[model samples]
Target: MQQPGTVDEVWPSHAPENYQCPFCDMASGEFAFPDNLCEPGDLVYSDELVLAFIASHGFDPEPGHVLVTPREHFELLYELPDDVAARLMIVTRDMAVAIKRAWHPDGVTTRQHNEPAGSQHVWHYHQHVLPRWNNDGLYFTPKRPIVDPAVRARKAAELRAVLEGGPTRH
Candidate 1:
């Protein structure tokens, strides 16, 4: 399939940015919400196959990025069963439509699991609905630049709260 608009010039994926696994001295909490793990629940449901979180931390590729993720620890998409796949597809498609209907993005991208070679870090199965816009940004967006050191620390703390499903933040 055609690669959706990439932030290649700006936002590149961290090779081995394995939030799932961390090297020594860094500590496991360091990897907490390492990358784009923030999402607010515009809508959500938990079934046998998957659980989803509406993207909370979003800008440039704007706020509508939806994450459809499996509940069980299925390493890859191939690991998903026919029934799960069917349900995932339904949710994925619905989110795509929802992004279009709600955000009116220039385009919508449904990026699924990628591996070490393809830059997959998290072993569990997941898909991302990144809403795209003209000049929303490629690599690092102007609106969503790399968080400053303090801000990054603060953001991680904020997401720690959200990821842990604790208090809400903005």
Candidate 2:
């Protein structure tokens, strides 16, 4: 079933661009996408081989979350060549550290790989890092707030700092 509208626009259009994937195309700058999506585009960190970005269709299971992705657009973790798989950990680690320091969250949750039975939405391989709160009207699972712009800026700063080299204090 459709997980709502986020993929609606992205999915159908992806096929016509000569079999190109939107995420990969977006990361490659071969197409135009929304700007200032998360302080400065969905992409936060990108190199010749990898790219990290804040999730755009973030009607999230939890708030203050981000997604780190690879440039080549592998469909699943197992699809990645060994070298790419290793780099994914580095990106995940860096994102986790930044999320911890910036959000002052009670903890962070890391998850990857879901299935038809596991509620995985996008087919592309990516990692999710969710910032947690303490007794913040959330329980067994989590909830997303309206995500104010000011908070987004602060978060961008926090992630940027962590990327630069800040302590990942709890």
Question: What is the number of backbone collisions in each predicted candidate, taken in the order shown?
Answer: 12, 0
lDDT of 1 at 26: 17
TM-score of every candidate: 0.53, 0.60
Model 2: residues >4 Å from true position, as ranges?
A: 1-20, 32-40, 59-62, 136-170
> In model 2, what lDDT does residue 22 have?
55
lDDT, model 2: 0.64
List the lowest-lDDT window of 10 residues for candidate 2. Answer: 1-10
Query: What lDDT tens digits, residue by residue, belong to model 1 across residues 96-132?
Result: 8877898788887777756677656655567888888
Question: Each model's RMSD to truth, in Å?
Answer: 18.0, 16.7
